[model samples]
Target: MKLTLKKGPLYLQVQEILKKRIISGVYPKHSLIPSELELKEEFDVSLITIRRAVEELSKQGYVEKKSGVGTTVLDNHAISKLSKGQRFSEYLIKEGYHLKKEFASLSTINLHEHAADLVEHFGDECYCVERLYTLEEKPYIHFKHYISKEVTLPENTDLLLDSLYEIFFQQGITFNRFKDEFGTEIPDPSIAEILEIEQQPLLQRIRYSFDINEKLIEYSVAYYNTAIHKYVVNFDV
Candidate 1:
């Protein structure tokens, strides 16, 4: 069947198509998926694109690849915990958690000197949005986002109800790639109180997102309460 690809990266489009097929049982559990050459012909995309899409599927645990044999689908339930390309908030909601986001603060700020190199192109100032997420009515995640001033956030947008990424997309901002750095730290008193923790450790993640033209668009830091929820990362061989 011919696939109508979307506007983003071809591999991502193909990945979504294949994932939908797997979830819909079009490619049943343990059944072999279309070979690379066959999928290439079907989608009229390059071999590299086809391979990347399949590689993503394998990494997400939807399928497994064997050198001699073709790719085989896995039980969807077995891979429900797999998180490959979703935002952390999206992952939590997909996992059946009741999530609520509250805007702790939203204002413009001078970029810190230490992180200045990360968004040097955006100059000295940027808009900052701080958010707190409650899962099951308890503090679960805290996010601090720094966005380039050049990228306009909608004045009519509601940060509490709408997704930041969705707002960016609506404003014609398309992400090309992202770089993430992970670390662990003990929260300071101020942050600890906001997170409702006394002395527990927090999983820290800093990510920089760039657009298709290679312009830095956003820098964000997230602190996760690992005692209540776990972070899972999947890597393919």
Candidate 2:
């Protein structure tokens, strides 16, 4: 492995190098990390620096250490890397699957307590919409969108089945995404019913926030079924 510390702290730089290799499959999941003494020489850094780097990697969910068993890379099952400016809808279209949309509901209501804070960030009056997207008749993604009630959308909104952002852009409302978070978990009972998934670990949840005209105006949550699809993201280290 090539190691250089021309920029950033030596230990942080070391951590990035190791993290890149691990995520890129240079070091596969559950594979053992090299001995500290070996890494010390490889990076041409002091042993303390090597140890600190390893510790940092552990904190970031990259690796784990065991007594008398050395360090092991963790399995990163969920897609965690992303290209700088790739759009999920564009990626899906490139895969040759036709995305279809089924609108569930759209209404103005008081924000549920769980989503109150995010709703407040947009505005006191929030409009919510629910939708399900399918690829070639196979149910794919379930999404709920919350936006400022002040911004009037179509009386009957149609999100083009393939791209919600496209509609926003066409309406001259450029979405400003503030947060994007994803994780793996068992499907909620209601979600499981909707997705027809019958077991645990069948779901991937994504929550994001966006601003309109420099004002926070949208918060969205999407649920994806992992049993039928896998996510892949490519990023430059």
For each candidate in turn, the TM-score is 0.60, 0.54
Candidate 1: residue 71 Cα off by (Å): 19
Stretches of candidate 1 above 4 Å error?
Answer: 1-88, 112-114, 233-237
Cα RMSD for candidates in order: 7.0, 12.8
How would you encode candidate 2's per-residue C-alpha lDDT over 8-120 as one tens digit per residue? 57887777677667755788998998989999888888888889988877765668889899999974321222224344655677788686686566778676644668654
lDDT of 1 by residue, 1-237 (tens): 555545678887787678767766789999999899999998898999999988877866678899999999974432232244454566678789898875557677876653566556678788877788888889988888888888777554365346666566546665556778999977667778889899677899888887757887888888889888888653334
TM-score of model 2 vs. true structure: 0.54
Q: In candidate 1, what residue range of length 10 has the lowest lDDT sum?
A: 75-84
lDDT of each model, Cα atoms only? Answer: 0.75, 0.66
- Candidate 1: the clashing residue pairs are none
